[model samples]
Target: MHRGVREFIRWVEAHRDDAEIQLNPPATTSDIAALEQMLGGPIPADLRFVLTRFNGGVLPAGELLPAGIEPGTIGHTVREYAEAVGGDFLDTELLLPFHKTPEGSLLAFDRSAGPVSDTWPVVDYYQDLDEHRLMYRTFDGWCRVCVAEWTSDDFGADFTLETYLRSGQRHAEVEPDVATAHATVAHALKRSGRPADSLAAYLQAARCVPPLPWCDWEALKIAAILDDEASAREAATRLASYAPAARWAQRETSPGRVAEVLGPIVRRSGDPKPLLRLLEQLKAQADEEEGPVVEAILEALHAGKDLPPVRPLREQSVVPHVPDVDAWWEASQAAYAEGRLRDDDLLLDPDMVRLGRLRPFAELLHIRRGF
Candidate 1:
């Protein structure tokens, strides 16, 4: 494998935890060969490197690839293609389908050019028309294309801003403060150098998630860049409210944030009395329920060990509140206190979630819509 490709794989591994991209693990060399052999074509060097590393997964390429054609691993993709279009597809030098387009067409590379050129041209093959149309001169070129707008038509591009922006917008509407979806839009706009537009997005993010340190921080920076003194001051004030949420924020979150939240004043006072008082208060709160989790938190505090923090902004989530949400919470808590429930019971409980105070460790659960 090329050193550059290896470096890219390392980057992918580092970022696979990001929620936006659906990255699969790297493919074994033998797995890559099987996929290539299944397609009856030697994969191009750049394309091969990416496929081997990512094994085809949805990337942060906004709008270019529609949600319909989710990138699948080479092995799964080829198997599906074969099952869909029998043995004859292997012989065609017409289109090498890599992505399934939202419009029910196949986005592929024109294999006919592969033999002559070091890099093959990309094409969109419409099976209904039995024709393939050139889209880009090379796979490398397609990979580098930056989508500036959104459209439903087949004007031609691998990534589109439409789907990505729409998804973020939907998430922001639902879980704004919890998940920081608006921040995704803001960050993308920043990267595209649309500072004015990015500032607008950051403002929306600040509104949706007022306590987000990054939103205020980014807004503060962007406002200053735009020379908007009023906006910068407003952002700085909001950032101050979040104070120490961002203090230990590395990338997204860390255990230190929890310590900071619980022990900040106690550590400064130099009084064990206050610390004990705080622990007594927490214990009183925990009196409603006590499991291994609360015990661990108390023990960690006493031993000067780190406790977990609140859910990371990007990973925080919430659910719809039915009228019965309160009732369900009460019942679940009682069940837990009585040892009538397991972790799975709380996890599967409709009222219990990572955002709200359902249990002692509710704040630390992975952010998702219902467990």
Candidate 2:
């Protein structure tokens, strides 16, 4: 076995737990190194990371070949062609470079073609010249198949492997169900009006259908239309809670909805205590999960305007102990100090600090205040 083949086998063996390995006899170390040098920068950290994790090697039979091709035939062809050409043609026919996309589609670029050559061998070389021009054009069909298979396995069913095989286009199709659901919810919410009863009905209607991208934005719009202060406050609180619950449904959900829903409520209520409390709870959740939902809530809070001052619960008031209260308190103070806490920090009682520490220093404060 060649040194390259041995190194490839060892790499594949290490990644045996992952997808099956496919063999490509033509990809050489020198070729890869040269390509990297030409790019004038390291390949993305992620690509290198996957390569190291999987190691490297020839894929198993029927494993890394393209969706509909036979791996045995691919291997046989390469060997027969190599023997016929007395191995000298190996440099031109065997060496293939692969480029993988984030969506897990792979394209094989034939480096043997002088860089000045006009003709390329992409899946769709000329059908849509401008778009497909950048696609991977492998020297051999087998190399293309091998790359496509590797990419499909990495991305799994989420990637559109067939699209690449049929036409080198990577357009993602939007599901109709999501579009219709969003439209239905948006229309229902927009038509509903003011009174608490009407608003409640509207909210219920909005909740009936799962939020999709279109309706996700509409949900905030409906929340924004609240006319009564109390109604708006309730809507805001409900919307904040709803964001997390409906997150999975909104494929394209953005954090801005949280702010859009809460902005009106905070401005109309005159008291920012509820918003602050909500923010605190969200911050706690963020610490625990560190997910998109929490990040969005933090962003929304940061962008809100005209928020009322947060009144301290009370001096010496017994407050319920929350997990990581000290850390939460410190973070809250930092946010307040940075002016990200809005004007609401004032609503927090200096006494609340005592609850965390269980010390009564009211007398010391009174002395300072000239009481």
Candidate 3:
């Protein structure tokens, strides 16, 4: 019932059916209480206000957090946080991710601001950079800012296609920072269901930004969402310069995931060679669960390629006729070297060939992903 939350919710309801707006059904009071119980605290009044009004909805601004914080929700408000409640990332028990900035930072609540029934201050948590900073005094203030950002002259003057196109017609007279403004415009266009324009705007934004991998990834995503092969290939080709393997090794990234996204686009719109090369390099560096992710990608990339049959590990071995311990010392060095040759190639030998995740990518593979 907070005025700010109430206002935003009303605005959302009024526009929810608009092709350009996005939103979900509101949650019940009981559902809110249940979530709070799971979260081991009282839900803040304003935060609850959003959830109650829209179980989770997409506004022209951005998608809202559902009661469960599923993939498409506002922030990285994962259900996993409930169990990892006291972990390093979830450092503050009272904080909960509520929204995401266009640039991908998360806006979470400083639940410690006051009691559950009271207002909670908002904090900006940079998901990629692992940085945190104060953003607004309260959720109410944040919503006002967001609403203003949508229609305010400073932010493209409008969130609709007509306004954006009109403003673009006078590009020199409006939107000083062409790249960032276009990117912002792209989001609005996307929400409005004009995906083709959104993709173009995203491409423009990608070009404006530095050769950053994330932006390229986002561009690729936008293109894939629109099912535009050429744009996806454009993003993929850019993504190659920054080696996926090197990047994955240095940071928390998922080449396998990227492959899953790009595979289909490549299949339809472009060549998968560059993407396959990127995946191969990353697979060389990837291990464990990512192994399967890479495997899945490889399978998708070259589903028709004949693969080596699965090899069994630790199977019962037949003892070959040998000189026995008498010649052990004499043959040990040679035998061990030979055994090394027989064993799995620990070296990144392209042809050393034992079935690791990627069976030595032969062809450029393709994959497709929805936005």
Candidate 4:
């Protein structure tokens, strides 16, 4: 057996006491042979070893699909998913699905990568987007991540703020240039009740390439809460510069949206003139609806009155197309209330909260996926 496979099994055995994890009996040799015949090729040696020992069952992060079609083996689903994909995104014949993630995606082996099945890479097939995302270079590589995730209680009931923070740091170390990792770390710190550290992390994220406006927005809020005037000013300035290009700015309510954030800063600064100048510049380039909103802010500034209150902004989920997320959140809340889960684990389970897995690599850096 491969080292990664051995390590994974050891970890699974170590945590076998957890009620949420289940390891079925090993696959019979004949069943394994039948599976290979069905695939029209030999299986990866490491995978065959895993099947021989544990067959397939549930893990915290995802389900290990069994071989030989015992209700959850994904026999026809593979071909159906491939057929749905239709395009040149994948080679239908060589795709062998082995795992099903909580997000309803399949982790499949792309057998066309090389002659040896062991060298084939694993790819995550997203049903919603009809896309295949390369997840690991080899089956063992995926096992390595699984071992790490399971060993550290990632996606497990014991998940905590520290777990999230450590995961974020690991991702940042792997992809230093990706702003999302730093942002995830910042959010984790915020949840840990460390506003100062969170603000610093957000600032660090904002300095990354293509500087995320969400990072600046969050930093601005934290600075305000921390009563750090210098940091607040810096965040506000960046937000102002990004206002024109902001997605929400294109709407008719753009001016009010801008005012909601900028107004508070202006009020706090006790200098409305600078904001007025910025509004005037925006007005020159603004559309008809946008001009009126800018004018409203200017009117309030000139009269030294409070800016009109706009609807409070709500932070939206970075995860997309998960319609039943509210139910997931309610479950987390119930679990936390019942003492079955930690406060941090309430909404950070990679198995429960869809955003949990994406945060480290993608979600936190952008308002929406693929943006």
Candidate 5:
């Protein structure tokens, strides 16, 4: 195998037990030949090298398509896409599919680049937009980017205040215009009990050109928490007065959600009149789905009943934990490593694969076989 591909294999193997890193066994010589025959072209040298050592599987960046003309294989998918779109973009000679985005868009090698396959650039084909854009100049370049993404400090890990801080700093430095990143940091800070810092971050997000409404929404919540009447009024005015054309604004600045967040604050102040008036103004722009929710909030206010607590952004996990799955996973992995448990054996044990740590592998297999 090529040295770079070998190093990637090593890194993946090191993380084999991780639920996120699913990889398949290497392809045989015949498998490579079959894929080449199906495509009627040579596979790029670097990609071919990697496939011989580790036939495509799920990666942190996306699903790497395995080689073959079989269902779910790279060649088969390329042909299928070409037929659907009626374009030369997915033509086997013009481009070769290698990966699929999380949304199922194809990323392929641009064979039109040159005679040499290894120098072919990678293009991200947006299925929805019917557009393709060059992403990387070479297969190795794409691989390096994927590796860097996975190796990043917070990759595949739950967010922590420290991670959020690091991410906030990086996003503020690298992509200062992205309001969502700033808002993420603000949320993390708010959750960590740093209202002042959180408010600052939210303000920064709101300062972005064409600012996101959610930033202002968050600022209002923080201002209410701090009892900063002026700041609260400013944020509330922004949320209630401005009209946003984007579809996302409907959900982001939903009056019902805003009311819930401000419920306790208004109750504490012994005045629901101001908030009720604000919601009434926002109700004009609320969609069908949101109008009812806002109406419910208004009814509760009129009845002098305490509003429910703010619903969390993400629902808490309700999946029951399996008993000693950790210990079973260790033993299962050990058995597999010793060849006591084959891939076929693991496949048959659907519960173990689905409920246990082998979920990633099962998903990969399902994709590969088009199950």
Candidate 6:
């Protein structure tokens, strides 16, 4: 185990009783086994250890602790309550935990929702809930949490929710340049009401940095609306270069738009080479089984009479072919006797010369061609 993981484990054990409110010692091994079967994987190691320690009893039951109390406030130890919750805590980006009511309702405290009772259950037994509105985390990261409304062997109504802890926080602290650029572009776009010409300019400015999702399409749509053919072409080409999978360029109808927007540029440019190259890339990508936008590119390429040959590339190898095992063995023995073979080389053609059975070069030569 890593040093950090070990230290965290020690801290969790020290505060197990206090940090986990409504604590109860875990059920027997059989019960745990059953829960594991239900969850489809082993419960995380740290979480397993915590449940084992607190399963049978409650510590601070019926009282909600403040945000960050469970993990951040437990102790100064690097691991503490945070580590005890296991990888899931970090993966989910949990800002706070929901308190389950006696009536089996789930509630969370959102300052954005305005003043409500201290206990605010998000879902009530009588009210229908929006599954997409319920946020949850996964082992990979915060994703739409899919909860099954009805359990079947195959499929169920899975719920998705937002990650409460915002993304890009670490980037802001660690990569100030990138964060600043993104913030600047975002602010500009917001203030400008997303004008097409302004968006095109911003796209050029932000091309070297990581993109915000859907930013390219927003720029492209703006360019098209403004009827700036050159700007639209630039936006399309850039979008194709950076993210061919983006939905705007991926639609089957997208090629018509690309050709309409970029056709004039293709005609007027000194050389058709750049346009041809872009067409080839789009065509090659379209041939793949994935991405609808590739198909759109294919349509555009065909429309422009710019499609390139789609034949696969072939390369030649130097190794000669031997017809059968007997011929291969005789050739191999001659090569070994001539000191042309090494242990590694012999291993490469095991059928011709088994590694252990092959004699040393000198002995093999003495026995063979009279060395």
Top lDDT hit: 5
In order of listing, the candidates' clash counts read 8, 17, 12, 0, 0, 22
What's the best-to-worst order under TM-score?
A: 4, 5, 3, 1, 6, 2
Model 2 C-alpha lDDT per residue in residues 151-209, reported as the tens digit of each score: 44443343232323222211101112222322432233222222233344334434432
In model 1, the worst 10-residue window by lDDT is 362-371
Tens-digit lDDT string for candidate 5 (1-371): 34545566667778878887688888878888988887777888788877877788887767988888788888787777777678653355556778998777888887777877777867778777775655555566566545554667787777566666666555454446556557767766654546677787888877775465667876875665466655666677667764754533532656656655455455555555676677787777677866776666677667878553334333321222356766656565555445454332432233433443433332211111100
Over 4 Å off in model 2, which ranges? 1-202, 209-217, 242-252, 282-371
Each candidate's TM vs. the true structure?
Answer: 0.33, 0.24, 0.38, 0.47, 0.43, 0.30
Pick the TM-score winner: 4
lDDT string for model 3 (313-338, tens) is: 22421112243443432332333234
Full-model lDDT for every candidate: 0.48, 0.36, 0.53, 0.63, 0.64, 0.36
Candidate 1 local lDDT, 189-266, one digit each (tens):
554446667677777766752234456656654554354545554554444333243342521322222222333233
Question: Given candidate 3, what's the lDDT at residue 242?
Answer: 44
Residue 217 in model 2: shift from native, Å? 5.4
Better of 4 and 6 by TM-score: 4
The list of candidate 5 runs beyond 4 A from truth reads 1-4, 88-92, 157-371
Cα lDDT over the full model 5: 0.64
Predicted candidate 4 versus true structure: per-residue lDDT over 1-371, tens digit per residue: 77777998888778778888898899897777766665666778998888887888898768988777434664445556556767332343557888999889889987767778877777778878765645665677677667666655455555566887887776565445556668888888766656678888888877876445567767765665455666766665555553454443322234344454455556667555666565565566556756676677677877878666443223332222254766554554444334453322213223533433232211222211110
3 versus 5: better TM-score goes to: 5
Clash pairs, candidate 1, are 62-160, 63-159, 63-160, 63-161, 64-158, 64-159, 64-160, 65-159
Off by over 4 Å in 3: 69-94, 114-117, 154-371
Candidate 2 TM-score over all chains jointly: 0.24
| Model 3, CA-based lDDT | 0.53
lDDT of model 1 at position 24: 54
